[model samples]
Target: MNRRRLTRWLTVLLMSTSNLLALPALAADEAANALITRLSTEVLGSIKASASVRTGDVTTIIALVDATVMPHMNFKRMTASAVGPAWRQATPEQQKRLQDEFKTLLVRTYAGAVAQVADLSVVVMPLRASPQDKEVVVRTEIKGRGDPVQLDYRLERTSGDGAGWKIYNLNVMGVWLVETYRSQFAQEVNTKGIDGLIATLADRNKVNASKG
Candidate 1:
């Protein structure tokens, strides 16, 4: 892999580790560990086999992403929140289209980054404060042979019985990915209307499909 691709994969892995940190300790950690184990065993192994047969096969990568990563990520909510006021102004169909397209874009981007998962270890640290009543930031460290990187998860409670924590943002080495996306979305909405923004996302999705 090129240096740029490796850097992108490292960024995605760090973001995943960071977001996995925001839950209520063991519950969140257990859920994430289970997911990782499945991915490492079933999904990763399959991807490796496919790569050995046909190196850099985009179809296999996208398939692995859809099966393993897309199911775990709440891209609809993330996209809706990132769009901010534009979501409120959009029609129902428009909102749905935007969400679908944006979700696909994210899935493709993250799937492409999955190539960066190395033999690194993710250590979930204790939350210094309680998150029972409100949102909290959980911290963790992704350690490798090189320097350890810090990851922080910004999560909030869903509307139900507080059964799960939904991750809305993640910080890796001090960079917040959600906030960055929000800013980019805001700029797009400013330059182009909501429909234009939706079109932009649709165009990106089309590009991703073409690549696959």
Candidate 2:
């Protein structure tokens, strides 16, 4: 696989390995590492036991993403960040469509790589954030393949009951996921406007669905 494809594969693998959305009310570092340690084994085991996942069944993978992955991810923030300044200009209905299409685009883009996550394990690195900090970067390494891939998560604390750290951005290798998408989305918005960008994502999702 090319570098981009490999990165995407690794991103999906790392993200799928842990449940970041509903972590316990602990220190950010503690919560991040604990979730990784606790869930990685179970997630990997499920993938190994499921023939559908190993064979890249799109429907199964999409369902898995929705059920297990989306809850923990702050996709509204992710979508807004990727949309940049144009997000403010988008109507509520347009914003909803954008988020939905963008979510589908991501689910379809990396869902096939679910099968590639064999014998992979994550080791959460030491945290270097002050307790008062609202946002922090949780670093980790995915071992058991070739060289360990450095994966990092940018999490922000949320307020209210049952609130905990939620992941808004991810880093695979040295690239941040939201920034990567932002560049692409910016181009679409500049040429086609917000609706155009939404249509573009919908079209891409349709093509991916057909291939599946």
Candidate 3:
């Protein structure tokens, strides 16, 4: 092969490898940003439109939470793991009931918390690192009129396969709410059994729904 042709082929190979290495990082960033934007907009918009002047806003918010939020949640895995060793001992019916009620309560709680969206803006910060091929953490600052809150969305990438870059965890003000709930849930299951825990969640959700 001629010297020029050999050099050209080598240059092309190098560029192709560089692009391949760069693609995942770039895609991860884009996916993370898109999730951040879409969720923040949908959530904030729902709150603003429903926070007042509507009695059925709670229902609407709950629907939105279930539709947009629930799919992204790893609720079965979350609940099973959160319940710890007790989860294994529960009857099939008990497990089903626990997962069902826990999902409902979490949706309601998250929907209720949307009331705090008033006068809040989220600033998506630069990611420290892209940790996995399928997941990324998008750091953000949530500034309310009262105080600035640190938030992070731990996102999973599906990348146009179907509603890509879903959020599985939301850290608000340095509190990983899901993790906190998981720990608390483990304790309740330890002390009271799965059925008792389900009852507690139902009661808590009832109160929360009334408030909403």
Please list the C-alpha lDDT of all candidates, in the order they appear.
0.58, 0.77, 0.56
lDDT of 2 by residue, 118-158 (tens): 67777878778877778888888878757887778888876
Q: So what's the TM-score on candidate 3? A: 0.69
91 Cα displacement, candidate 3 (Å): 4.4
Q: Between 1 and 2, whose lDDT is larger?
A: 2
**Model 3, poorest ten-residue lDDT window?**
11-20
TM-score of 1: 0.69
Which of candidates 2 and 3 is the stronger one according to lDDT? 2
Q: Number of clashes in model 1? A: 0
Give the residue spans of candidate 2 off by over 4 A: 18-30
lDDT of 2 at 77: 98
For each candidate, give its TM-score against the true structure. Answer: 0.69, 0.88, 0.69
- Top of the candidates by lDDT: 2
Model 1, 34-99: lDDT tens digits are: 433333234334434444212434465445544544334555667777888788898999888887
Q: State how far residue 54 of model 2 sits from its true place (Å).
A: 2.7
Report the C-alpha displacement of residue 43, candidate 2, in angstroms. Answer: 2.1
